[model samples]
Target: MTCRVVQWATGNIGTHALRAVVRHPDLALAGVYVYAEDKAGQDAGALCGLSPTGVTTTRDVDEIVALGADCVLYMPRLCDLDVVCRLLSSGANVVTTCGEFHHPASMAAEVRDRVVAACAEGGTSVHSTGSSPGFISEALPLVLSSTQRRLDTLTVDEFADLSYRDSPELLFDLMGFGRSSTDLAGRVAHAQAGFGPSLRLVADALGVPLDALRSHGEFATARDTTEIAAGTLRSGTVAAQRITVEGVRADRVLLRFRATWYCTTDLTPAWDVRDTGWQVTVEGDAPLDIAIRFPVPLDTIASVTPGYTANRAVNAVPVVCAAPPGIRTTVDLPQIVAALG
Candidate 1:
């Protein structure tokens, strides 16, 4: 069953989604939503640096949604409830890499209610997932817990070099990439966004209700000035950030999710600085520590991140299209079988 997929917001992850949609044997690139005026009217494949696909990109959301795609690969940098609702109202099931309701139950009452209303109105479904908070934080932990007799602490630590990315907002604004060392404010910038819902889903999967959930942040200063695809990092500035979210039971940390993202690999004591992509630590009667790395071309790990997120969303299109109406999580969907056949 080849699913008709629309690529939404051709930036960052969306660009990768564009390529994935056209290439997947079980998926077809029905259309695309172009945020930039220059991108509109361009062939979807050409836009993503591939052979020209017949599907042309459009800036009008209504037009793309009206194309009646079976599912939308919603990988925009930032997503909003209204935008998601608009897509759902058009009766297109949505599979997102990030932004809006990784776990709908963890969302605010009004926002969740409206999203549910839209889904009900159009009989569509929505699923949000990504590598870290989506899979590594949710699926990986649940898989490892099956071997645990007495579970203590489960941690998912992600380390990535940000110098591989070209987005200024991601490097500076979202991550505080080049900020001063004393800027604690920059450290906690992304601590509160999507981690809470992720922690909630993780706790739910483990069958352990958390007494509390907490956010923590720390920084690694740059020893010298450095330049990256985003911009320049001044000496003594924030080159790396370690942000964490933990689900605690009775004051003891049960599930801990930490992301150590840096611009340079030369930070102090360089944690998780190897060729490995991510590390998942499970501490219990049977303690386990595993490191995950993608054997991609050298110096392309950061650039491959969007592909990781993009594939997760694209591969879930058939599942999301088959799911019942309303917002769903990775916990709610079945295993994503790559439609390589």
Candidate 2:
């Protein structure tokens, strides 16, 4: 059963997904959706550095809907509800990297209702997944918890060394690196909204429904001027930041996720930091400490990081497409078995 797939958004992650789809034995490149006019009319293969696949890319949503693909790999940087609803309502099962749809119950009532209605109308399903909130925060914890009958606290620590990432706009302008500490209310809220859903989903899966979700952020300033791939980090500027999201139940935190992102190691207040990877520590009857590291060198992280996100999404297509019509979470679907042939 070859599943027809549409590759949406040819960005970093999407590009990797496109290449994977073209190579997968059980998947066919039915269509390609691009956001830039320059990418339009180009062969999908060319966009992802493969031979011509005969499927041309398009900037039109209507064209994509008309293709009636079995599944759409939606990897846009930012998600659009309208586009998602339209794709769902058009009968295309969606597998996305968007963090919001990871846990449907965590979504706002109106947004959830709209998506539910769309799924009902088209008789399709949508799933949200990615490397961080999806694989690390949700999937890995669920797997580790199976070893314990009496579980206490589960913490997932994510560390990313962005010193070699060359995206200036992303590091400096967007993430607020190399800047003085200002009001972090917005950043805190963003972290809560981004990671809270995954935490809630994990809690619910563990039968420990959270009473509330709490989030906070902390930052360390640089001790001296440093040069990074993104830009310059001046002395006494924000160099490292950590955001923690907790799932609280019965006045205790049952699940916790902390993301520590840093551009430089030299900071006024030294903090424990690691390479780009994740550490999962479980405290229970069968306590475990596990570390998953990206062994790639810092210079090539940009080239290799997308696969961590895109490949999981691509592997999930078959399961998501076969799922019952609704929003499917990591808990709802069976283990994703990649058809690597």
Q: After superposition, how far is residue 251 of candidate 1 from its true place, in Å?
A: 0.8
Model 2: colliding residue pairs: none
Model 2 residue 30 lDDT score? 98
The 10 consecutive residues of candidate 1 with the worst lDDT sum are 181-190
Using all chains and alpha carbons, the TM-scores for the candidates as numbered come to 0.89, 0.96
Q: Where's the lowest-lDDT run of ten residues in candidate 2?
A: 178-187
lDDT of each: 0.80, 0.92
- Kindly report which residue stretches of model 1 are placed more than 4 angstroms away from their true locations once superposed: 163-180, 186-189, 222-239, 263-276
- Candidate 1 per-residue lDDT over residues 1-341, each given as its tens digit: 88888888888778887888888998888999888899888888888889988888898977887799888888777777788898898888888876567877667899899989999998999888877667787777877988998998988887766676788987788656788753555445455466777877878876788888888788887778888888888887888778888888988999888877778866754555555378888899999999897777636665776777778777888888999998888788888888887
Which stretches in model 2 have alpha-carbon errors above 4 Å? Answer: none
